[model samples]
Target: MLGSMAIRALSLSPLDSIAVVVHPDDPLDWLPALGNSAFSASPSAWPSIQVVTCTEASQGMSFSIRCGLKALIDDNPKLDAVVVVLADQPFITTGMIAELIGYLSERPELDYVATATDVGGEGEQNAILMPPAILSRSMFEVLLQLEGDAGARKLFGLPQFRGAALLAADRTTVFDVDTPADMVLATKQILGQTYIREHRF
Candidate 1:
């Protein structure tokens, strides 16, 4: 699943590097699996792809975020920003990632660009702000301060952080695979179904 996500991200022309953060429990298993995947099989594959293992993954998502961020920063000290993508979001596409990068690139004032979903209402309902988010170097310190299960979404509420939201290309693009039902829905979406009868509103 993560390998597919990596391939999608790497396919984008705007991205210069990709770091896949794996859990500590099965680092050995994941490393070999990803290396043997189709993306890594090609002789002309990008050399920027790196596999990082989060030693503190058991603590929560923050550990993984820290691991990936540290590796990226160490690899490229001049990195302008990073696109934090979730591997479980199989529906995310290169276009969506390019949109986020484009938004931030065009607006130098904004600290970050995140995806938002409209839940459907008369006024502005609580928007779901999340990844594939682009975070500038200015936000790196704050991001490292995060702990536990808390992620970049928590930073959206901070007044100090100036952020612009991009409407997701579609609901499916942001739909992540967590539960068995979500897996079923993602499978249906992958199969080219536009609507799920059981989930129609």
Candidate 2:
């Protein structure tokens, strides 16, 4: 039901740019379209759209995020804003992303704009955005030094990092593909049929 609802829900606007970071063997899927629609087409606008790859992504989630951010900044030093999106978040629609971009577009001074989802299992909603603040190359490096398993949460509570723009979205938005069970759910949702049922399980 969550997947169906996500497919129907109206979206906001396209982000200025989206960072689609994934592992080496990850599927391309709709990611290339996201890049083409948002970044590749408009040269004068946010022309620097990119799909970043984390060579060390095999290490863990932290490495993937750190690598992606570094790649973005390394390629475009003048980037004022960015949105970090995972490769498998099929529910993350263009409208939701646009909402975040529109908010940041209005208030450029805001450090970070994250999509907040109520993953009830966590007791509190989780924030999905990276750097979690507007940081310079040096600050990002320092944050990278702090990296462990948990990733961006380490820098979010820091002093210099201003704060995050918590834009509320559906809880199902954060449903990530972490395992085979997750894969089943994704397949069922995308195809509108249960994989288990199809396989006679």
Candidate 3:
């Protein structure tokens, strides 16, 4: 399962608890299978994960984020922060997840740390901050206040928020499956076809 690959990446991260948020229409039963598969090849000390069904997922991405954060908080009140990664990003790896967590860890003052895209220019205005992101618990309340399609990145612009941006090392690492063409490429990568990856730029 493609999502299993994504979950495997998360399972390998240095997290205490993991929560897989499923939408209303998704097969909630897949959670167990995915979790088992994810941890199969993971380290023996891999974190245990629970599946959460976001009933209001149809409302917006904000709902999914809220549901996921709440689940994680409930599972472990002492949880200091979380790294949010989209399941559609099949190419996401354990190192990428670790890097984001490490970046935020190195700077304890950070409210959030996210993948940054440099739109070929200078300065902060030319940069765009997106997930997968590490959000400190201090910023959780603000995320709960988000509505509509606004994601965690929306909170980056809030007044006095201290967020860091890790410039993405490769476009493939950020490649998200949003279209049929994307799925085809993801399939090619999954099958170990090297040409597509070598020429992805």
Give one digit per residue, the lDDT tens place, for model 1 in 1-201: 544654555454378888888775663443444444444235255547777888787798888898999999999988889888887887787788888988999999999999888766422256678888999998999888889988888888899989988877578778888899988877776655434544678
Ranking by TM-score: 3, 1, 2
Instruction: Give the best candidate by lDDT.
Output: 3
Candidate 3: tens digits of C-alpha lDDT, residues 1-201: 567778777887777778888886897554555546335464567787878899998888899999999988887888899888888887777787889889888999889998877787764568888888899989988888889988888888888789888877776777788898989988887777457656787
If the candidates were sorted by their lDDT against the true structure, best first, what order would they fall in? 3, 1, 2
Number of clashing pairs per prediction, in order: 0, 3, 0
**What is the Cα-based lDDT of residue 186 in candidate 3?**
88
Q: List, residue by residue over 66-91, the lDDT tens digit for candidate 2.
A: 77677777777776655555555556
Please give the CA lDDT of all the candidate structures.
0.77, 0.53, 0.81
**The 10-residue segment with the lowest total lDDT in model 3:** 29-38
Q: Where in model 2 is the C-alpha error above 4 Å?
A: 1-53, 119-143, 165-167, 193-201
CA deviation > 4 Å runs, candidate 3: 28-44, 121-125, 193-201
Pairs that clash in candidate 2: 11-95, 12-95, 13-98
TM-score of each: 0.83, 0.61, 0.85
